[model samples]
Target: MNGNRFGRLFQLTTYGESHGDAMGVVVSGCPAGVELSTEDIQRDLDRRKPGQSMITTSRGEPDEVRIQSGLQDGYTTGTPLGMLIENKDARSGKYEPFVTAPRPSHGDFTYSAKFGTRNWGGGGRSSARETVNWVAAGAVAKRVLEASDHDVRIKAHVSQIGDVEAPEVTFEEMLEHSEENEVRCAHPETAEEMREVADQHQTAGDSIGGAIYFECRGVPRGLGAPRFDGVPARLAQAMYSIPAVNDFEYGIGREARTTTGGEYNEDWEFDGNGDPTPVGNDHGGVQGGITTGQPIYGEVTWHPPVSIPKSQRTVDWETREEKEIQVVGRHDPVLPPRAVPVVEAMLYCTVLDFMLLGGRINPDRIDDRPGEYDTDYHPRSPENVDD
Candidate 1:
């Protein structure tokens, strides 16, 4: 019920549940006078909306974003911006069985243990549906950041599905090709293979896991605040909030553990003015928690959809008796495609927050002008923050 809010200066709070009347968000601290409207936010929601393709859940919610406050004349008013998306596709009948028999790999049991009861319909707050609000709020943050002359961009694609691996593609190719398929994979050949894999699992009444890679470009040389607010830490925290996400790592994350120290260390280069730039971008753009003006990259592993039609065994929370459970509901056979925009929004929100934390970006001053960013936020001291 608590802790749904994120960010320091430009913050947001999400409310409602998956099967509730609606799910919505209240975004605060955004500078007024920026060009915005329901369309700007709806564009991202359309990408995140469920039932968009055969790969995602069959639930067809319009995912229409309604801006109720904080804007006048198509601009922010510097007040809390509230928006809502109704849940038209919710069906509680399928979840009736889960009232007593908790679904494995889901928060049903933990939620019951922590709270006396839960909204069993569609996993409630624990559902991936909760991420819709994030996508919406992050769209707002992205717009605010764009107005400041900062061109932070996030790209995510399905890197792996079960055992299938997508071939490496350039960021430009990814932008062009990822959305062309239901799998949202950068590689056309591998996306076909991934679809075949998902179909195989669905036919067998099982689910498959996949890995998603996100690349952040155009981030400043220094952002991320230090102590507990490192970029990687915040990235992990935001991503972990999504259901079915089991693992995360940055560039050379586990790979570095296998290499020797000298092999893993990134060599440095100097600009004409003696500024440091790594000869190789092996660090993924961060050193000591601060960005180094290189691309920031990382990956998140998404566990297969937990609510398969196959029957599974679980203990009854009420009677503590073992029983069979069949998870039946509107769910995605593969969720990677729908998750891409959400990932992009979150990365933008994180980097934009760090940018504000490092300097004073008056929301009121941001506009359509280019190269108008206030440089006071660029971190001059590496020790102050983590990238």
Candidate 2:
């Protein structure tokens, strides 16, 4: 019930459950007078909504967003932004059998032990269903990020689906080809292969998992906090809250064990203009807990959806007796393709918060608005930057 809030200055707190009438987020601390609309948030929500492709869940959630407040005349009002999404296609009965017998690889058993009860419908608060709020909030964060006086942009792609690796592509290639594939991968050929893998697993009543790669560009240096908010720590903490995320890695992440310091170290030097330049980004984007102003790249790995249609053994909550039940619920055969946006959202919130903390986002105040403050304050807007 607690611990729903995320970020320091750009905080997001969510409410409601998977099978509840609705789930929503309360986004606070967004600067005043930024352009925003339901369509902006809905665009990101559409990507995360269930039933997008054969590889994802078939829940058929309309996921229509309702902006309860925080915007007036298509611009932010500098108040708490309330966004809601109704659960139109929830069929709690599909999970009736799971009420007593928890599903494998699910939060049911653990949730019960921790909270003394579980919603049991689509895994309740622990469900991937909760991520919709993050996506909605991320949409707003995207705006906040854009308002900054920086050229930063965040994007993610499905780098791997099970054992099928997506063909390597340049960042530009990833941007150009990512939307062309149903799997949201950057390479067309590899996306087809990943889809085939998903089909195979779905037909077999099994599941598969993969990793999502993300790239953050144009981030200004000095955004990282020394300890509690270290770049890696903040990113990893946000990612770990996502359901079924198994592992996290950044540049040279988990790949430096065999090399010496000289081999894996990201060299540092000066550019022709005498500005610091990273020779190579073996440290991802952060060096010594701060941004190197390079394209920060990393990945978060997901395990296969635990709620396979096939019967799996579990325990009776009341009696602790072994039980087997077919988890006849809609689920994603592969997660990375759908998770791409989520990675971007988390990064947006993380980076935007740090930026705000560092005074990088200088927003405007509306004139003649009863609560509007000084209207003369203005900082560089990212949209005006030469990316």
Candidate 3:
């Protein structure tokens, strides 16, 4: 499709469908000589893969990633990094009925209206399964950022599910506890409550909406431009691109609505190192569309998944009759728990893109040294082999 690509400088173009043979991504513009491996990419994929817990989808796909190109001796080659993940567990029999009937609140109707036909199996290209490729690409971006001179860290956790909300926590707390539970919430007590609520919804054959809290630390200042290319604007595009994400807010977000300028505006001061800094972070690390050299914190709200086991009515375009259908296929009862990794992946890609665009990182190589080919990561000629 036309919109599969994302980012500038460091670009990601994804291909394949949910029920197709495989899902793949091409990550272009990655600098050479960065250490990368199938294990590095698979770690993130396992987090985003289905069947991780009782709250997520039960699909048994292992989500094993195969690196097809763009590496030499475990380092990137500064070319398109091609990776593939097979869809071994995609069951299409359950989706056949919806080909003509169209699932309510799904892309089925819209895709058909626009494209005149679609691969109705497992919602085809419009499925959340498409995000698998995004996580794969983000893994590559994560490695790139890790190899850079800057220390960039990105993390996200389930902040709310239905009515259960986690208390505000420190970045350290999020790092320490977010991945310890199946719900992926930073607070243990709140995570239990969220799990209970998710169970209730699943028992009722319904779904519930939730929110994710994300933070980006160590992003240098002056990485974004004003107006259309602003940091917040680009972040919104990235966060909203994830399916089911209904809203995005950064830096005190909606609370600014009732806040006076005096109460909301952060005063500037000099840090111990004689560097200008904001006294408070009400702007969520962006001031006037550029980064403020502080932690970028925000929340993204997700609508309940449209698919459910509960009966729903839809009109069959071909039969000219209303049909009641129950989405009995495997699906998630709640999304944020598994979405944590996906959110982090996207944040990694976005931050690295800004770094490259701002000239903070080298576009050709992580070492930032041009016209020099003999590097430690480069392979050596075989010592004893004779041609």
The lDDT values for all models are: 0.83, 0.85, 0.92
lDDT of 3 by residue, 133-165 (tens): 999999999999989899999999999999888
Report the Cα lDDT for residue 277, model 3: 97
RMSD to native, candidate 3: 2.7
lDDT of 2: 0.85
Candidate 1, 143-183: lDDT as tens digits: 88767767777889999999999877899988999989888
lDDT of 2 by residue, 1-387 (tens): 788999888899998889999999999888887778899999999988898887788898988999999898888888999999999988888888777777887778788888888787878888889999999999999987665557788888988988999766778887898888889999889989988998999999999989888889888888887887789999999999888899999887888787798887766799788998989888888888888887789888999888788877888867878877788878888778888888889999998888888878753332323445657655566654666
The CA lDDT at 276 in model 2 is 83
Query: Between which residue pairs do clashes occur in model 3?
Result: none
Ten-residue region with minimum lDDT total, candidate 3: 376-385
lDDT of 3 at 64: 96
Q: Higher TM-score: candidate 1 or 3?
A: 3
Backbone clashes in candidate 3 total: 0
Q: Which stretches of candidate 1 lie over 4 Å from their true place?
A: 272-274, 367-387
Compared to the true structure, candidate 2 yields what TM-score? 0.92
What TM-score would each prediction reach against the true structure? 0.92, 0.92, 0.95
